[model samples]
Target: MIKGIYETHVNVRNLENSNHFYEKVLGLAHAYGQPERGNSFYWIGGERHAMLGLWEKEPAQVQRQHFAFHISLEDMKHAVEYLENKGIATRNFHDDDTGELYVFGWMPAVSVYFTDPDGHSLEFIAVLPDEAKPELGLIPWSEWERMHGRGV
Candidate 1:
């Protein structure tokens, strides 16, 4: 069975800047990589965990993309404050007309969207519970067990 995603590779223009942002700003660890291969990698956990990779490319060659991190409401607030303190404002925040945040096109999740210093779109999202039980509606963590299929 497919467990989960181990890594995501992104194209970047400068490894130094991207490394700095992912490490210092995003608080991810610098993992293994090779400049000769035009790739640099980082991870949230350690070597035993999956990683995120950045491949060096021309500025024009780098396409704009969006990535998300599943986080709790408290973490989401902290992340928003952190980004704002770093001078990155939310392009759009809070639930929109469709009871979703940034529900643009195919994206379906309750998310907060902002950009990194390099202008890469970043989203901190919390997916709605599949079954909207009375206690689960808009209640953060009230149904986390159900949402994640945890046995309690």
Candidate 2:
């Protein structure tokens, strides 16, 4: 049976830029690289936990992708600023740079999104320790706290 996502891949136009973005900006450790083959590999959430593959391809050949990385709730709370300070713009689920984390109430998870050098959509998310509220759909974290009768 499947356990969790072990790896995911995305296409980038320039392997160097993508590597710098994933390694320096995102802090994913380099796992391997094949410069002649235009492929790069990185480790996420530490070695052997998860992997991300970046393959350099022609602009017309690249197919953009969207993926998320699991993090702790505390990190999710500061993700926006953390990214923005690194010169990456974080956006809401609506694709707006509102500097806020939205909760998918159904799973009661918090997520914030940003894009890589290749414009591939990437997200940092964490599951909240609360009951599911599917009816709530997607809402800001402040709203979720208020609904639970607590101050944000």
Candidate 3:
């Protein structure tokens, strides 16, 4: 039986650059890697736990993929600010027509989306408690917070 994902691998044009991004931007620790094979590994949870691997490839052909990292609500907020300060764009999918930086009310979570160096769609998500979950439709984080008296 499958317990959980142990690791995920993706190809990158430059291992060094991807390493820098994963380490500095995403704050993932660099785990041991096979330099001869042009591959680098990063610890997603812990030093020897869940991981993400970057394989160096010439003419890197990366298909856009979506993945999310579980985080606390506070961390999700901080992550959005950190990315914004770094000039990285973020997006959220809500029921309303207006585009925003966070998705809330639906999925019982708040998420902030951005792209990696290889154009992979990444998200930092914080799952909310059952009592706090909405019945339907997505709303902006700001709106959800305002309605719940959480404030920005």
**What TM-score, computed on C-alpha atoms, does each candidate reach?**
0.67, 0.94, 0.83
Best by TM-score: 2
- Candidate 1 lDDT by residue in tens digits, 3-98: 988888788888888887788877788878787878878875567577888988888978887787676544654655677687666645553333
- The top-ranked prediction according to lDDT is 2
TM-score of 2: 0.94
Candidate 2 vs candidate 3: the TM-score winner is 2
Model 2 per-residue lDDT tens digits across residues 62-129: 87788989999878767888998999877888876565568899999988888888878888889988
How accurate locally, in lDDT, is each candidate? 0.64, 0.87, 0.77
The RMSD (Cα, Å) of candidate 3 is 2.8
| Tens digit of per-residue lDDT, candidate 3, span 1-152 | 99998899988887888898889877899888898999998898787779998998875476767788888877876776788787777766542335454545556788877888878888888886545555646766777777668875
Better of 2 and 3 by lDDT: 2
Q: RMSD (Cα, Å) of candidate 2?
A: 1.4
Residue 22 deviation, candidate 2, in Å? 0.2
lDDT of 3 at 75: 80
Instruction: Look at candidate 2 and tell me the lDDT of residue 59.
Output: 99
